[model samples]
Target: MSDHERKQLEDFLAAIEPNIAGYNYSTFSYLAQKKGNVFELAQGRLVLQGVPATSESKHFESPNLKVGFLHLHELKTSVKQFIESLLTGKLLTPHGELRFAPEKDRSHSIYFNPFHAEGVPFQNRQAFQYRQMQLHIRGDRRERLDSLSLDWELKAGPIPFEGVQELCAEFGVGQIDGDSSTVEIVAFSVAAIGGESSVTGTKAKLVINLVDGLEREKASIGYRLIERNAVVKRGILSGDALTWENATNFQRGVAELEVTGGAVLHCVASHGGRAQHHYWVADPATAQNPFRAIHQAFDKNLDVLQELVTKAQTKGANARDLEIAVAWLLWMLGFSTTHIGGTPKTSDAPDLIAATPFGHLVVVECTTGILKEDSKLSHLFQRAEKIRQTLISCGNQHLRVLPVIVTTKTRDEVKSELDQAHKNGALVATIEDFPQLINRTLLVPNAERLYTEAEENLKRLQNPSPFDVSGTKTNLLQ
Candidate 1:
């Protein structure tokens, strides 16, 4: 960083030190590994290497490919199987090494249904040329944030092109067509998405890695961190609801930390007001409750939002500028993970979930335009109350669902609505007063200020320089 950049960062840190401390935090990103290799945890130690493909798939790479990933829908499907196994008193694997994909050779990118007996590795380039399905993941999403490109093919017989189509659609790819080469074919269309779950106590990330036609390797890394426990990562949601399975807990935590590191690089972080004094980042041992990290981050967003509203030199801004500036704090809270609870029909989706350590859910929302002291702020309370009631009527009200009414107005005015709501029984919180979050104490220096000032400067930067007749000219948009 240049002197100017360094100075700016220092200024940012100095500005938002207060709000972070209350959130009670200590820790930073904690993930590591290499690409094109396989990783599994046996005893708190990471097993990283290339998973050899089945003999039939080995020639091209591996005959069969197995990738251990987290999928909410898939989990639901496995829920019944899990219950059946338990009831039958089936022998349980001593080590909770859950297999998510087909067992295949390391090089084989193609994935087949694991329901049937396994096959042998490939012996010819034909498999490489004819693809069955190529899995493009947020590159090493568990440990590395960078997205990657991987392809798998079928050579033993005519490719099941339809199954390939089905898989392609899942990644937003249109279809495939055989090229001049007999074995090689190409698919069209692809996209990706990513975020972090600060609310889901499980904190398992969702990796969506496709966008438009171009694919950015580490597409989207997301997790739901909604737990209140000594070791936040240890309370992950797996095996069953209301319970956490010690399923490669250590390895999974490491991968999640790795993925978060990669994803946060694309975002930013910061806090302010009485909350920074106790924030921890260097040594995690002295950190606050890890489970509730995301919730506290969400609360701190109000502080950042207040700062942004105050920093606004002008009374008005471009619509996009206003939206981007206010939303900055919400996203910074690391609300990347998408939470799934309701069935396919009649279920509502919360903008955020404040979860308990044992998979309990809390709903929170942040809305713009609630100027401090504005009478409309009262309406926010009504909205929150209604949301709470809706959840209650659905029988989920038994859980502590804290709905918040967030705005970017100054504290003097916001405090009124907050006070009124507090008196009326709303779980009111400000982004400025959230507790320290262990997972994001030092997410990025001066993140709140950096993101705020960056957006402001970015807006003004649109003013173009004079046509450069004598100096180097550049077009950065492309």
Candidate 2:
């Protein structure tokens, strides 16, 4: 970092220190709105609209006030890009320099602290608003005041993989493990989604490899200390390629750690003047065998989502696995699905056929690669049309048959071909939509609702926008 930039960061940190000090001020709220053009990073409650930026207090009072700002130019590029920059340690803030962390620093106060305890009064501490808290009935007041600090935790919900992937590609994380081709960090033996009951002593173990020929001598690595799915701590790991084990309890409290699980180990490794951000996730342990039945696998295994996400990200290499996982997910979403591609007789047919009880049906095709061939869309559309005709002939004219293509590719990766998919009357579900699909399965679990959602998404994709280049959604629309 340049001296000017360093000074600016230090000044900003100093200015915000009072706002972040004390127990009451240990955490802040972050929100991105206006479709990512505007983001609020406030030490107190963040209001989206009508929050005026005040000169006297920097932060707002109650009804409407926010305390952070980014240049229009900075946000115009993209919100995800901005976040990726921050995660990769490119963006400097009050916390520490993201790229560097002090060795053995369990308190990652350096990573990012919207909260700082420099000038804020000890008496002004915000009670019941901390990630990790400890209270002593009797202690030296001066000593207690002198020892105030905050641990790193994510106030925001889980971050999507797309953001992490983009960061790695942009900064270029060098070789780890044996693969130098791209970001290849993996988490083994941990549940990808959920852990066992809180009483059980099943601990989650994570193994990270920093083998020979690694471009960087040291990398900043950290993990989300989780209780259930909430992050209790975000601490730095001290060694290279070490096996880290989860604590059975949070600071020896009643609340068990890693139970009902969600955990992530993040690393920012630099090489060739670029730093890459990689994540390894583990869900908590479950009693159900993941290899049993499709439904059992989805029900008992906490790692189902991660497994599916991995398959989608890897795509072609594990194309068949992706197909089966999607099919299984559709089934869990209350769809009566037929795995057509699984059988030799229907190998040439659409990959899967999913139908709602109310006669809404989707002809599904799974792909992990490009979808540019005219013949491919034509074929999917034709098959769907044939199915529609067949239903009409069978006196089910009210039935709906929608051709759908599911791919692990990102929306930008398939943007150019979206018009073709729309032209062919096909609903193209990219990697962006997969998570929502799974979330809907958990949230709604109604086939009819998902069918409606698919229909709506298709319409939205096919429709023309009402805004021009200078309009509100021109650049901010996700």
Global lDDT of each candidate: 0.27, 0.40
Over 171-271, each residue of candidate 2 has an lDDT whose tens digit, in order, gives 22211111111111111111111122122334444333222222222432345544422455665433334333333211000112343323322222222
lDDT of 1 by residue, 140-222 (tens): 01321222222323223243322333333332222332211001111111211122222123233322212222212212222
Task: Report lDDT (Cα) of residue 334, candidate 2.
Answer: 74
Candidate 2 residue 413 Cα shift, in angstroms, is 1.0
lDDT, residue 233, candidate 1: 33
Against the true structure, what is each candidate's TM-score? 0.24, 0.41
lDDT at position 30, candidate 2: 22
RMSD of 1: 24.9
Worst 10 residues of 1 by lDDT: 41-50
